[model samples]
Target: MFRAREYKICIIGDSGVGKSCLITYFLTQKFDSNNKVTVGGAYHEKQLFINNEPLHLQIWDTAGQERFRSMTPMYYRNADLIILAYSINSQKSFSNLPGWLLDVQKYHDGDPILSVVGNKSDLEKYRKVETKEGKEYAQSIDATFFEVSAKSGTGISEMFGKIAYQVAETRDRAKQNKTGYINPESQTETNKKGCC
Candidate 1:
């Protein structure tokens, strides 16, 4: 009788920052060299297991172009997590992070889990944005940060694993709060009876 939960995750960043590529690689485990840009937004899902409980991740890959900025909010509504991606090789992409963060805050209802991802980690040789700078910026905003290479499939599993665990914890807490269950002993029993 295990209950399944679904979490919505959104990715936002400047164009050519590899937002689409990251999602594509995560979903299919194959990188597209053509670099097809996302138009408005795209939705994808993956069924994951956290602590033996099923969790469905509804991932939204938003367009990074300015023309699609206005519609981005629609895709991020009710998102449990938001990933701010930037190319490590592009300083301009990193510089535009403030505006992107503002946009997410302006539209999302509450404090969703914000993750700062430095994409294109495989291009470290040409990197303009240092790892320290990206980490510091993420720290400044109190967001989780990871340097990942969608092209090389590096750090992808760890990042997604962290997201799944976090979102599951949030859901578990919400469920407990809604039922006013504060006793840890009873809570453990309730969880064992198939709540996740």
Candidate 2:
């Protein structure tokens, strides 16, 4: 049996970490040079095909300003993935990654897949955070790390695709455990729809 799968993802970071640009480029495959800052938050989604099955992504972009910090928790509910993004050119953004990670851990329920992203990779010359540092941080937290260039649309699809697969696999394991089934293939398919 195969059915549609949907995952809600929340993106958080400092004001100019390019969170909105990452979502925009992921959905449209084009960059918006004149992109405006997200005030409270923004919601966008797109239907993607993974392994020949439809996988829907609900992406929530939260404002990074101090005023919006309180509201960030509201979007974390029922989220399957939380992406902590930092700009490669902004040392402050990179420095603030742990704060954002703590915010999500404090507010979000259960366990969700966490991804650490270093955005604006195209500005390599102006990089302030080393890739090794980002990778180390992600490893310390048991999260995935990605360096993406939203402006050039580099590493966007691959990031999302891998995250989607990882989320689905995690969900499948949880579901299987609930059914007291060790082998996923042996699980009943009456209400199921897709393969992980």
Candidate 3:
């Protein structure tokens, strides 16, 4: 039995960290050597099958500049998953992730699943954010971390897979809650009342 699920995800990080490049690479599989800095944000959609079930994902790639920060909360509110991207070559980008996470926590209702991506792995020579530090910070915030190179298409598929898995899990939990099996007391109360 194959069911289709829809997921909404957002990519947020500091400016010039290749957030747009990552999206372009994942969806189009083509990298722009002269990719322009995203002004506000960009959107992309991709579909995949998980356990033979079709899953459609809508991804929002947000700008990382301070001027654009105020508009981020609106997008974060509706996201099922959030990806905080940073460049391995830029320490400032990595350092700014905590503030971004804080924004998500403050504006979003529930605790959303997050993934931290240290992009530009192809430029290992200029790497600034240590893998151990990145992973540790991700762990501190309960986020999954991966080092990826949008240029080489490294780890993009796995990143999306993680997002899909989280979405599937969330959907399954929601389904259980809707069926009332997850909350027996609520189910009992509802069943006691007349059909309405």
Candidate 4:
């Protein structure tokens, strides 16, 4: 029997950054141009198979309006992974990323994986933020960077696949450390159990 493990994730950024659209596209594989502004927040669940192991992702999409800013951090608490999305055409959204990152740093103590997503890659012709700039900023903050399009369905699957694998790896490492399981790759001692 396969046991399903649940991982909590949160999406956050300034308003109009396509946070909701990205989630919608990921779940439905279709983008709704008329998606209503997400108030307070919304929850979504997706089941996936990672290395033949059942996995559940509890995705939380938060409102980006200024009025909802104060309430957003509460949802981010205890998240397993946080997707910080910004529009490639909106310099303001990209500029505000640091503040959002700081908010995550304030609320999350477990060091959840941070993914800085440059959304709206379909509108690259109108992009104000350069790809290199986003990559450099993500690197500076020690986070993974992805340029994805909720519209064209470009780079979405690859990004999520990487996220799922990374979360699984983090969980496995935590479990091993907790049980004092020595990883043979880093072990010099003989007769040590090898990493599975």
The candidate, 1 or 3, that scores higher on TM-score is 1
Q: How well is each residue in 30-108 modelled by candidate 3, as lDDT tens digits?
A: 8887888777777788888765457888889888889988988877788888999999999999998888988998998
Candidates, ranked, lDDT: 2, 1, 4, 3
Q: Write the per-residue lDDT of candidate 1 for residues 1-196, one digit (tens) a residue.
A: 8667889999999999999888878888888888688999999998887656689999999999999899999999789999999999999999999999999889898778888999999998999999999999999998889999989989887788787777677666777889987646434644444333
Clash pairs for candidate 2: 2-193, 3-193
Please list the residue runs of candidate 1 whose C-alpha ends up more than 4 Å from where it truly belongs after superposition. Answer: 1-3, 182-196
TM for every model, in the order presented, reads 0.89, 0.91, 0.87, 0.90
Better of 3 and 4 by TM-score: 4
- Candidate 4 displacement at residue 1 in angstroms: 2.0
Error of 4 at 167 (Å): 0.6
Give me the runs in candidate 4 sitting further than 4 Å from their true place. Answer: 182-196
Model 4: worst 10 consecutive residues (lDDT sum): 187-196
TM-score between candidate 4 and the true structure? 0.90
> Candidate 2: where is the Cα deviation over 4 Å?
1-3, 182-196
Candidate 1 yields a Cα-based lDDT of 0.87
Error of 3 at 31 (Å): 1.1
Assess each prediction's global lDDT (C-alpha) against the native: 0.87, 0.88, 0.83, 0.86
Q: Can you give the lDDT of residue 54 in candidate 4?
A: 70
* Model 4 Cα lDDT, one tens digit per residue, 91-190: 9999999999989998887788888999999997899999999999999987889999999889887787778767877777787899999566333432
